[model samples]
Target chain A: MSAVAKTLDVKGLNCPLPIVKTAQAIKELAAGDLLEILATDPGAVPDFNAWTKSTGNELVEQSEEAGVYRFVVKKKG
Target chain B: MDDSQGTLSLVLFSGTDDKLSSASILTAGAAALGRKVNLFLQYWALENFQKDRIAKDHGVSKDAEPEGASLMRLMREQGSTQHWADTFRQAKEIGDVHLYACALSMEMFGITKDDLDPLIDGVWGVASFMLEADGPVVFI
Candidate 1:
């Protein structure tokens, strides 16, 4: 039983947009709900890591395949 | 890891797009991480923001003069490049970030609140900004 409420595909959007969209999406979810983000930006790896740390969001699971990166983030207040 | 130092304070003085873009990247990166970000714009940086031309100018630094044209062309081709100011504004929606104008610079240049982008949170003297913002400050 996963807490994930939805998935957001922000592939092809680079840098700030990806993060920007993710931030926007997370807002609609309740605390403890999860969001799955799919992105193609190679920088997403480090960027996601840093974002999770700063925002107090929980990066529950993450994986990379080829150029695409997948992330599961739990909303935290 | 100085994660405890979770605030980013930037004193942006350059008017060029390259420098602004760098600041935006830092702001977004920091903001996304849940750190607070404060940007104090002054001199040329504040001068560049003409509301009508808010997102149109891409004046590059003298150092990047040689490659400026090609880089801009590439950016145009990518179509993914966004104005740094807009990036900063968007970052605010997700995290704790603020944009401020330098009071002395505003007076020196005859800039009014009306002249600045709406994204600017407020105007304050350098002393005031320095007092309120602390952790890590970057001067551009």
Candidate 2:
């Protein structure tokens, strides 16, 4: 995928907060823009996937290292 | 799944902070997923909805008291000052979420809107809520 157009830093935040912040951040981007999120909440893994599925956004990549989960999501066109 | 018109409903019976945290998390998720959410508060949940009681109502369920206290302490240690109230408020801001205090509970407790946090949408009964909610409802 192309380079991310925006990044959301939600480290140290918990469930619903990270997802909530992601939703708000995604709203600011235009269609097809990429969103990068950094989160630490253990629930964030499945939460992001579910949010993308239900919101019709695309979660292109995800990874975890040192307890931090990173995700790249593409907004629906 | 992006059907924005879909709905998720909650019947909140417990007033404990742990349950509230879980319920609010689910509410926020549904809202983020573009679904409307309806929260029906009764009994203890209704009583806890009072504006003055919200801040101080931070106990978990009695059965899990030991674990709950430690977990709460851990969350506090990790800088988790965000409460379920904040979650519910943000859910409303992000999507179409409505909160109702059961009239039956209200009558029993002699409660009014003036007693509740402003986040409550209105007072409603079970029948009307059932008819209007066209989605899954979970009791918390």
The alpha-carbon RMSD values of the candidates against the true structure, listed in the order shown, are 2.5, 2.1
TM-score of chain A of each: 0.93, 0.96
C-alpha lDDT values of all predictions: 0.83, 0.88
Please give, for every candidate in the order listed, the TM-score of chain B alone compared with the true chain B: 0.90, 0.92
Task: Please report how far candidate 2 places residue B19 from its true position, in Å.
Answer: 1.2
Q: Interface root-mean-square deviation for each candidate?
A: 2.9, 1.5
- DockQ winner: 2
Give the interface-residue alpha carbon RMSD of model 1: 2.9
Model 1, span A11-76: residue lDDT tens: 887787788889889989998999999999888888888878767888999998888899999988
Which sections of candidate 1 miss by over 4 Å?
Answer: B1-4
Model 1 residue B111 lDDT score: 89
Candidate 2 chain B: worst-modelled 10 consecutive residues by lDDT: B1-10
Best model number under lDDT: 2
